[model samples]
Target: MGNFLIVSAGQSLREALSVAENNGVDPKAVLDMLTTAPTLFPSPIYQGHGKRIVEDTQAAPFRQRKIPLKDVSLFTKTAQQVELSTPIAHLLSDLLRSDEARA
Candidate 1:
């Protein structure tokens, strides 16, 4: 659960780091390691959140598949309601909607 929250809320975390840095705080050491997990336990976390599988349910071909963005609009709306800046959520929502429009 902790890993999910920390890894999934990437956009919000970046915004937080920006705010912290602007206020003369330094947390580069902590921020630098979010990309990959430890060598021992690497596969599971990546397979779940970071993998972009073929979205067969969509009309597009296998080559056209993208990351499965789970209900980004609802998630972003909730983020806004909570005064959170989730730029990734908005971007994913826009991308998904545009893809739908293209189909």
Candidate 2:
């Protein structure tokens, strides 16, 4: 399985601010990254914590012809939860480059 960090948006933002202060990086940059993450990463809404509905049944009340299934959206947790890859996390640390390193 691929390594992933499941974190709430609030927690991630708080951590980003803390990391920026601790590592001398710009917090605004981190916030910008967070804002653009969805477009860049295109993560699917994980529905592990959402409600489930079983459509298949052994018996039905009436006999009907099989019909094409329509698009059904499942319940998912709030937008607060996010799943980030480890490589992206490493890239965040790379933002803490010194002037000499940038040279």
Candidate 3:
């Protein structure tokens, strides 16, 4: 949910909401919908140790490549273009870039 909050402030979400608003969708109504939606994860973990950690370590390099930095950069770029604030997203993106394990 917290991550979603960050994502919701990112470029992709900013662009999407702009489109929604252009189509007669009210921004406040969209937020209200979210407030009314059922919660899927009562408690969510951002980082988790999965069952195959040992096995997964062998493919760590490949795994890192699979994470979409392109999307994140694009999101940040679009946020700037749209004049929307995305501090959290930008922070996450910066952290992602610096993490050698992820990079």
Candidate 4:
């Protein structure tokens, strides 16, 4: 499993591919290495008073999909934060750079 961190408000698949190209990573390879993982953060507020205690059991998972670069709404409402490992970042950088090279 490769790690990639994408920092953006929201971008389409094509935009993401462009980013990957700018980062010098292969778009196809990135799609192939894609994985879907969801993470849920529990609410800090307590539901009940002193007599009763209620805990919120909500978990949100991160959804990863292998999509075409032309799809612009892929990154919409995906995640608020992302963290990618070095190798993954490198790959992405390569992709983005390649795109720039073509342009």
RMSD of 4: 18.1
Model 1 / residue 28 / CA error / Å? 33
Candidate 3 at residue 65, lDDT? 24
Give, for candidate 4, the lowest lDDT window spanning 10 residues. 45-54
For each candidate, the alpha-carbon lDDT, in order, equals 0.44, 0.30, 0.44, 0.30
Task: Assess candidate 1 and give its lDDT.
Answer: 0.44
Better of 1 and 2 by lDDT: 1
Candidate 1 vs 4: which has more TM-score: 1
Note each model's CA RMSD in angstroms: 11.1, 21.5, 15.0, 18.1
Residue-level lDDT tens digits of model 4 in 41-89? 1111111110011111111011122221212122321322363234433
- TM-score for each model: 0.38, 0.28, 0.39, 0.24
TM-score of 2: 0.28
Predicted candidate 1 versus true structure: per-residue lDDT over 1-103, tens digit per residue: 2322433453344444456557776535334344346533245443322222212213222223133344455576677888999876666556556755675
Clash statistics: count for each candidate: 0, 0, 0, 30
lDDT tens per residue, model 3, 1-103 = 3333433333333344447667898744443443333632222221111111222433422134224445566777777897989786676576556653544
The true-versus-predicted C-alpha distance at residue 91 of model 4, in Å, is 0.3
Full-model lDDT, candidate 2: 0.30
